[model samples]
Target chain A: AQTVTQSQPEMSVQEAETVTLSCTYDTSESNYYLFWYKQPPSRQMILVIRQEAYKQQNATENRFSVNFQKAAKSFSLKISDSQLGDTAMYFCALGGGSNYKLTFGKGTLLTVNP
Target chain B: DAGVTQSPTHLIKTRGQHVTLRCSPISGHKSVSWYQQVLGQGPQFIFQYYEKEERGRGNFPDRFSARQFPNYSSELNVNALLLGDSALYLCASSPRASSYNEQFFGPGTRLTVL
Candidate 1:
């Protein structure tokens, strides 16, 4: 069994600022995958970033990055130059081995104030 | 090409009723997955089908079932619906060529049970 946890229930940031959402996970698989997905008011879940457990290098998108600590089982997402469009519910997920199922956290509500 | 698409944008049902949700994956995508999002929670994986066969399943009850067609389209059926079943059902698809590519998501079907 695998589980993902997001400590922050809600977070607010100003436009152009930077914010980081925290995530931690537990999995029996020695090798696994970490992902951050964002769901906005449009009701669609979009991939923000993903980190492979084997890769020490953190995964990053244009404005989204992740600090993945494999030893600590921490996978946090950082958003720089945040925009209004960044306001959404962010989820941390775990996927591993031959099991294609994704175990997700409860999610953190992020609000970017203009 | 258009992204993943889901049918019956919204639905209302009563306890003991049955509901069916549909999804069409992106062109050339053969791996389809289903998830259920309950209000403020993150989406929970339900099923995954690839090449017209069941590849993975989550912790969901047997009441929740799904299948993929030859065209890569899929349907999720829930029987004995309860108030707890009210949620947003999301479908995601990914090309099988990419080992760990992010799944493209649909707008999701919002199901409300009374």
Candidate 2:
């Protein structure tokens, strides 16, 4: 079974600053996919970014990027130029080509202060 | 194109009761997955269906079941609900069963089991 861990329960960053949310997972599969999801107060789940384990190059989407270290089983999300709208519950998830289900971390609540 | 859509944005039920939640995946998407997100926690995979067939299921008991139709719409059913079952039920869909594909999510149905 794959388990994702988000060590930080909560994180705070000032507007226009940068913040990183750490994530680690336990999986035996070498080829897999990782993702970051944001859930706002409205309870809508939004996709932030995604990374393929086979690709060494990290995934970047606008202000969001991931530092994916396959050997360390660590996939961290970095939010640059943080805005108030970025404040939400962020989750890290794992899935592979053979599996359709996604295993998610406990989540980190990020607060972007103005 | 419309994103995933879920019905009964909010629902309340008592223990030992049954509840059904519906989900309509984004147009052209052929896979639908269900997840449960408890308060202050990450979403947990419940079930996944592709091509109208059961693809994967989580550790949840038989109390949780789901089905997908030809149109790609899905439904989650919970029987003998318990208080611990209270959570936000999310529906996500991808173009196919490919793990590398990104999933789009719906706003979710907040189920309160009292």
lDDT of 1 by residue, B1-114 (tens): 999999999999999999999999999999999999998888898999999999998889999999999999999999999999999999999997222678899999999999
lDDT of 2 by residue, B8-112 (tens): 999999999999999999999999999998988888999999999999888899999999998999999999999999999999999997557788899999999
| DockQ of every candidate structure | 0.63, 0.79
Window of ten residues with lowest summed lDDT in model 1 chain B: B96-105
lDDT of 2 by residue, A1-114 (tens): 788999999999999999999999998887889999998888678889999899999999999999998889899999999999999999999988577888899999999999
lDDT (Cα, 0-100) at B8 in candidate 2: 91
In model 2, what is the error at residue B27, expressed in angstroms? 0.8
- As a whole number from 0 to 100, the lDDT of residue A100 in candidate 1 is 89
Give fnat for candidates 1, 2 and onward, in order.
Answer: 0.67, 0.81
Question: In candidate 2, which residue pairs get closer than 3 Å at backbone N, Cα or C atoms, i.e. clash?
Answer: none
Judging by lDDT against the true structure, name the best candidate: 2
Q: What is each predicted model's overall lDDT from 0 to 1? A: 0.91, 0.92
